[model samples]
Every structure is written in structure tokens, then in C-alpha cells.
Target chain A: MPRDEFERLDSTWASVTPPAARRMLIAAAAAFSARGYHGTTTRDIAAEAGMSPAAVYIHYRSKEELLFQISRIGHATSLSLLTAVTGDDPVARLASAVRVFASWHAEYRTTARVVQYELSALTPEHLAEVAELRRGIEGAVREMVEAGVAAGAFDVPDVRGATLAVLSLCIDVARWFQPDRGRTPAEIGDLYADLVLRMVGAKAP
Target chain B: MPRDEFERLDSTWASVTPPAARRMLIAAAAAFSARGYHGTTTRDIAAEAGMSPAAVYIHYRSKEELLFQISRIGHATSLSLLTAVTGDDPVARLASAVRVFASWHAEYRTTARVVQYELSALTPEHLAEVAELRRGIEGAVREMVEAGVAAGAFDVPDVRGATLAVLSLCIDVARWFQPDRGRTPAEIGDLYADLVLRMVGAKAP
Candidate 1:
């Protein structure tokens, strides 16, 4: 089930953020992801968390801050999950990265939906920070593409475009995934890993 | 720069839709794309369209109607554009379709963004209509992929997954396209066509 991913995400979040604050952020993520940032109110978020509206400010300075935290945590987790796929070969690295990235997007789709879609609502300062983390994720993918091309492990015509497409395909999972629908997260990850390998023109291990 | 695409979309919209109603839809599409559907107010749309608040109601019954219209038009255009690319050969058809679809997404990004990203704001009845339209686009891609594989022109192992990725990559252009960014819509179209051609393991003709 999704319990493993949720627990993993929850513990990872708790490592850097307080539990009460994380609860508020979780509520904010769901509301923001579903109703959108502008549609969601602090009162709605507090109500979702089963707390009085006044209690929100004790944990988050504003509704935007709640969104900012969700975006931040989501980006950090995405970047870390992507960059963690390390190995001696770029082919394996790329496939592993795509698998993990795709899995996380599907598993944590609620948080990812807000993170990926609600960037415009973030304060400029916060948006910039999130963008940097996004760049980190992009950079990790670009590195794998370059490594594969340099080693002659893959035959990509346009490295930058392929890198963008790879990230694009993975991030879109958050947009379209429904847990009960067609494929499981693992199935999607496995499918995408193969498709990505083909994308890079990887011959074989 | 993007004027050609804007004019083209405008003319296409005018062909079937009334000019005044189209104007409101254009405004709502921009607002919904920029600020999100829920984030954008009917007042904001009316003001942006240079009409009084009540003028908006004269054209469209409600803000949701405005969104439904835009989504409907966008889906129609997307389906037409994708299916319009036809040839005896699957490779050529697929490349042409991706090129046109990607170009439109980049060129008419605001409309495409609202069409692609703002569907959740659409009421269920409207969303089902749009989803059928979306399925048309998917069916077009799937046919091309299946034809390519059947003809032995492409080497995709998983037809459904590859179809999903091709559409995923093209649709994502709406999410990330910036007119002032590095690549033009035409350029992106050409780049994606080549990449997608490569993606299907098509042997160079």
C-alpha cells in the first residue's frame, strides 16, 4: 500500500520540521492541491487539521507560509530522491533515478500536485528558493544525460531537450496519477524506467 | 513574436464562437492560466476584458461557464491539431502531430495552460466532456504508435506506455513554456519531433 511511502515522507519531514507544523502543512497541501492556493483559506486549513482558525498562526505565519513549507519539503524530497540514485554507470543511474522519481511523484502525488502547480502563489522569495531546488533536480538529470552521452552509453541527439523531457514526463505523474487507476506506482516506475532508457538510446547493460 | 500564433488561435476561435463571448473566454483563459481557475475572479476577467462586471454575465452565465468554454475550445483545437497530421507512414504522422501539438502549446501557452491544468475547477459534467476530448488526443497518439510498431518502423516494447509518454511530454509544454525563454515554439516543435522520433526507436529513413 501507500503506507510505506507516507511513513517515509512523514519521517523525512519530521527530521527537519516540527510535527504540529507538519500537520498544518499537510492540511495546507491537501487544500491547496485540491481547491488551489487562492481558493484555500487559513480557516479551511485549520478546519482540515481540526484546530481553531487562530491556532494556524502559531505554527505558520500565513497561508502562503504553509504553502511555502509544503513546496519546500516537496522540492527537497524530490531532489533528494532523484539525486540518491548513484552507481558506476550512467545507464543504471538514469533508470534508477527515473524509477525512484516516478515512484515518489505517484506515491506523494498530493503534496507534489501543490508543489508543482502552486508555485505562482508563493512569495517571490519562496518561489526563488523552490526554483533553486527544482534546478537541483534538473541538474541531477542533466548530469546523467551528459554522463551517458559522454560515455557513449546512450545516443541522444539533443541533450538539453531530452533532459527537459525526462523531467517533464516524471513530474507529470503528479498531475495524472490516481492510485486506484490503471497502474500501481511500481508498475509506472518500471514502465518509465524502460521508456527512459529507450529515450536515451541505451543499448543494454 | 508570438503574435502569429495569437492571431491564428483568435481566428480559429472566431470561426465557431461569437467574438464577444470569445473575448471573455480569452480573458478568462489568460487569468485562469496565470492565477489559476479558482484564483481568478469573474470581476477580474470582466475588467481584463474591458467590460463591466455585469457584462460578463451577459456573455457567459458564470465564471465556471467561462472556464468550461475555454477548456472545450482548447480540447477541440488540440484534438483537431493532433488528428490532422496524417500520412501513409506512421513515423511521419507521429512527428508532424508532435510538432504541431508542441508548437501550439508553446505558442498559445495561456490557453493551453488553462486547458491542461485547470480541469479540476471544471464541474464534473463539463470535465467529463473535456476528458472525452482528451481521450481523442490520446487515441490519435496511440494509433500512430501502434501503426509504427505494426509496420516495423518503430521498436517500442510497450505501446500504451510509449503513447502515454509521448502525450505526457507534449502536454507538459503548456506547464513550462515561456515565450521569452530560450526556444521558440517552432524550434520546440522541431526538437520534440526529432526526440519523439528517436524515442520510438525509429530507424532513420
Candidate 2:
């Protein structure tokens, strides 16, 4: 919190932040989302990013690492959204959290698609990190569900199954949702939130 | 039914069913399912079939055609399962159909995974065919839900949204399901069927 310590922290962050590497990561995420990880090569990502294949190596050690970076960001964003939606009323909090999660997924579908479909390509260690992040997100939702049950605001029999079902509903949207689809993202998000509320046996507020 | 016509039909079918081609189709399905469509090549499929790549060409015109065949088979199998579960009671029939669907998806996760995930890789023409087949499956479920609604056996507010939510839950099991995850396919199928039934406000029979 001291001025000199804060300046040192900022300098250290700036030193590691490579703009070219960030562009390559974006390109890799897009390619990996369209084609599975096994289907893409470093050259393909490099071409998309307008960089030499060797330049990609300079930024990341391997294609898997690039994917891990994308997954890590997506998982962290989702966890942060969940953390930000806390409230005294668990039902209202859960509905808001579900809406935020669904909207984020629909808006950033490419990242979500890559994270969901290409997870098997990660090394065991990277996979564990991603899985742990996922568990943290699930835990947030589970806590809200448990709180609702304890407060008599929800009547779900199995909190874990309910959480999985709600999350599944949101995550699978990336597969079927198209921008030209009849429903807007917000419309879909609202509909899913209603469905999730019903599934959790939450009374309309 | 005449002998001459029967011979004509048999010869027509034989001309379409070369042994090398049959092997190629099977191998292509497995390859597409395992490595994904874009990740797989004709050579990989040919090697799996123990035939030369030229041999695969002799049977199918291109890899796209091979994918079309696999998608057709998967769609037909899924539709047949739904149709086979018809019953007098709409609720029972709905639950049974969902169980069959979830079980088939779990058992044949690989083929279902490929068909669902790699659908975008299909040629526009082939995609239309698959889409029609998918609509047929959705239509059957929609009709069942409508019947249940008419009979007052279900209390869902939005039939189309409910149908989509139900299908999404079942289709997405292939994404996260692992045999080592403590939940068997059958158990997951049962749990999903129960959850779907509850969501629709169906009374357990």
C-alpha cells in the first residue's frame, strides 16, 4: 500500500504485459473456438494475428499455454461476476448472478466455447487450475442456493444437482446461440433466469 | 413385390454398399467423434479402417459426405429412441423419452459429441438435412409437451422455452460426463429425467 511498493508492483505488471502476446492470445482464442485445439496450429494462430510463428513462441511456450490463458481469464471473469452479485436476499442475489453469468457467456461466447470444448487439450496441471476455478464459481452459486434453502426462500431437493442444471443451461447457450437468432442475448438471459428460478423453487419477487 | 423388382432393388442397394465404403464410414464416424471433424483427416480415417486413402475415395466422394452419413445415422438413432417410447400417459411417455435420450447420449457420447459439436463443419446442404432431422426430433418432443399441456399433466409457462431447456440439459451431458466421475450414465440419465419431470410440474408415477 506504500507509494514506492505500489510503483514497483505497477512496473512489474507493465514489464510482463506484452501487447503482441495479447493479440496472439485473442487470435488463438478465436481459432480454437472455431476449430478444436487439436485442429489448430501455432502457424494458424500466427497467421490470424499477423505475426510470424516464431513470434508466437516468444509470447507463449506452447499452444496449450495460450489456451490456458484464455480459459483462465474466462473462469476468473465468471468468478468475479459471481462474487460481485452478493446481497442480503439470496433469491434476488441468485437471480442477478444468473443473469450476469448468462449475459457474460452470451456476450463472450467465443471464449466460453473454447474453454468448454477444448479443455481436454490442456496439460494435467493446467487442467487442474481451470477445474479449480470452475469449482470456485460453482461454490459461489452453491452457497447462495444453500442460503436460500436455509432461509426458506427456495425448496430444491439437491443443491448440487440444481447448481449443475442451472450452470448447464447457461454454458450450453454458447453452442446454440447465434447473433441472428430471434432472441436478443438479454431476452435469452431473462428467460433462462426465470427457468433457473423455477428450477430452484424460488418464489417470484 | 415381384421377383424382377426385388432383384432390381437389391442390385441398386448393392451398388451403393461397397465393403470398403462401409468400413470407411465406420472409421470416419469414430475418427470424427474422437478427434473432432476438423481435427481428423481422410488419411486418419483410412488408416483406422486399414485401407488406403484412395480406397476411401472410391466409396465416399469426400470427407463432407462421410460426415453427412454419420450425422444422419446419429439423428435417426436419436429420433427412433424418442418414437419408441410412446405411451398412453403423456407424463410417463415424456419421462421415458427423456430417459432414453439421456441414456443414448451417455452411452454413445462420442458420436453424439461429434454430431452436436462439429455441426458447423457440414456443408450448407448437409447442414440443412441434419437440421431437418433435428427439427423432427424437436417436433416430437414439442408435440408430447403440447399433449401434456392439453391433458393438464404439465404446468410449464413456455412450451418452446421448456422444450429447449430440457433438450439443452440432455445434450450437454456429453460435455462434462466422465465415467470416473462417480455418476454412471444410467444414474445421470435418471437424475436428469427426474429433474426435467419436476421442472414440467409432472407428478411422479
Candidate 3:
């Protein structure tokens, strides 16, 4: 990881007010990523943060609540990143979207793992909340594909299927990314962006 | 799911000796998939199998062992499917490989879930054992990609990266597949086959 990327990952929780709450969220994400959500207890989160177990309750009512916060923030951040992408054309826009979205998963592997894998551990109501955000994420990708197709810049037989494949390819990055091995996140982003353009039948940019 | 597909999923454990042990493995897969390895207990597995808690021990030493068995078997089964694909051309072979491998995740969603997600819970020795099968799976895909490039049937800039994307796209089907919604497993297979060929720069079949 580059120094800037490392610093950016460390500052993921900077927006969370009151350092104590942010600390708990970071601890919970680490625990959940290292062990499955079910395997981590509130005490474990507290211990990881060097705070008393009761201090954890002060910021979050329960472990699941902490998970929900981590998940919501992570999803929102990724969605913003996707929607915020700027490019000169549909092809460039979609490629840029894939580049940033795919790399985010690699750079923020810990939060990405917890966000992607631990959804089933959330309460039904909380899951519903996160699912709405997920819909936004999916919609963002779909729209980019659709725009490229509509602009006659890309050829896609089944837009939904193509969109699914693109998102699936990117989302699985969190599961397998290794910091010490293989390509850097930016390199992955570049590779994926090129491959995704192929899938969508976008002309070479 | 079709009746034949349902039966095929049920027969997944048919090769495991002794109907009693097969039943226990099936039970463990269901439990581990539903509640995750950490949230599930030996008692839960036994209850799901309709046997005493002690009966579980008779079949498998521990819950982690049961997970190991499911992971090992599932990985082996998918690996065989990938390597068994036969076609007159590299394009056809790669398409067949992706089709079956991706659909297997959907058709056998329960086992696939446990197989892909619960590996972390396996003991290190068991995990290493399964990782060998995983390597075989990766090698199978890489070889098919290499064959395509060698035959001038596909244009791939990065063989290793393309191979990773191909396998990643297929393996992730397990995480999002829903039996009651959207496309059938076979339909997904067809869609993915087309998209993957597009990915490798294979001409339309």
C-alpha cells in the first residue's frame, strides 16, 4: 500500500464524532474481519480497543449495533465514491467507476470484509437498512452500464447480467485481496477497468 | 430449482460412505451455512440430523472437522467439474468451465455457502488440505485461459489477472444467489458463458 493509501485507510473513521465511538467501530471491524461476526464478542471489541466492556455499550447498545454502524458507513463511503466518479464520456466514466470501486475494496480490505461477509449477522430490521444502501450501490453501477449502452458507446446483450458480473467481479476483491502479494490496489483497479470495458463491449478509450 | 437439480444437490453427499454419516454431513452443512461455524454447535448439527449429540461425535470429532469435511468435499467437487469440462475448442471449454462452476454455486447454494465462507473456521491443517484443492481449481482455470491464448482463440493482456477475474466472478455466485428470485442456475450459466467469452476477447459463438 502507498503511504497516502495507508493513511486514508487509517482515517476511514475520521468522520465518526467522539474518538471513543470511532475507536470502538474500528475495533469491531477488525474483530469481525479476523473472525466471523459470530465469533467476536463485545468483550473482544472492548479488549481490542483497550477500553472496558461497559465503555463499548456507552457508544453502541450492542455488538450488532456496532456492526450496523460499520456496515452503514462502509457502504455509504463506497457508494459515494462510485457516484462521485467524473469522466469525459460513458466509457471513461464506467472505467473510472470500476477503477475506484474495485480498488476501494482492496485498500479498505478490513471494513470491506466485514461489510460484505457479515451482513447475515445483522438483525432483520438493521439488514433492511443496509440493504437499501446496497440497492443504491447496485443501482449506481447499473446506471453507468445503461448509460454506456444508451450512448451507443458500448454493446451489451443483457444489461442486468452484465451489471451483475461487473459488480460481482469487483465485490469479490475484498475476499481474496492480500496486501503483501500480487498487484497493488491501483493496478487491480486498472486491470479490472480494462476487463470491465471488454465485458460491456466499450470501445478502447 | 428443478427436480433434477434438487436431486443432484441431495446426491452431493451420496459418495460419502454410510448413509448415516452422509446425513450428518448434510446436517452440518445446513447448520454451518445457516448459523455460521461459530454460531452453530455440535448439538445444533445433531438436532438438524435428528440424532443425539453423541451421534455427531461418532461421525465427526468436532464441528470444525465437519466444516473441514464440507469444505474439502465441496472444493473437490467444484474442481472436478472445472477439470472435466470438454469441448472441441478452448473457447467452448472455458465457457463450459465457467457455466458449470458458476451454476454449481447457485444450484448447491447451501453447500457452496459453507464451502466458500466457512473455510476460515477450519483448523490450519484442514485448511491447508483444502487449499491444495483450491490450487487445483485455480490451475484448471489458468490452463484453460492459457490454452485460449496459445490457440489465438482469445486476446488477453494479463493471463493471470484475467484468470483471477474469471474465477472470482464464478466463486462469488454463492454469496448472492437466491433460489426464488431472478434467473435460474442454467440461465445464469448461459449469461455468464457469453460474458466471460466477451471478457477473454473471444468472438461471438
Maximum-DockQ candidate: 3
Report the CAPRI category for model 1.
medium
Per-residue lDDT for B95-167 in model 3, tens only? 9999999998888877887787767778899999998998899999999998999999999999999999998
Question: Which residue ranges in model 1 land beyond 4 Å of their true spot?
Answer: A1-9, B1-9
On TM-score, who's better, 1 or 2? 1
iRMSD in angstroms, per model: 1.4, 1.5, 1.2
Superposition-based RMSD of candidate 1 using all C-alpha atoms, in angstroms: 2.3
lDDT of model 1 at residue A127?
91
For residue A159, give model 1's deviation from the true position in Å: 1.6
Q: Score the docking of each candidate (DockQ).
A: 0.63, 0.45, 0.68
Q: What lDDT score goes with residue A52 in model 2?
A: 96
Task: Note the residue pairs that clash in candidate 2.
Answer: none
**Top lDDT model:** 3
- Displacement of residue B199 (Cα, Å) in model 3 is 0.8
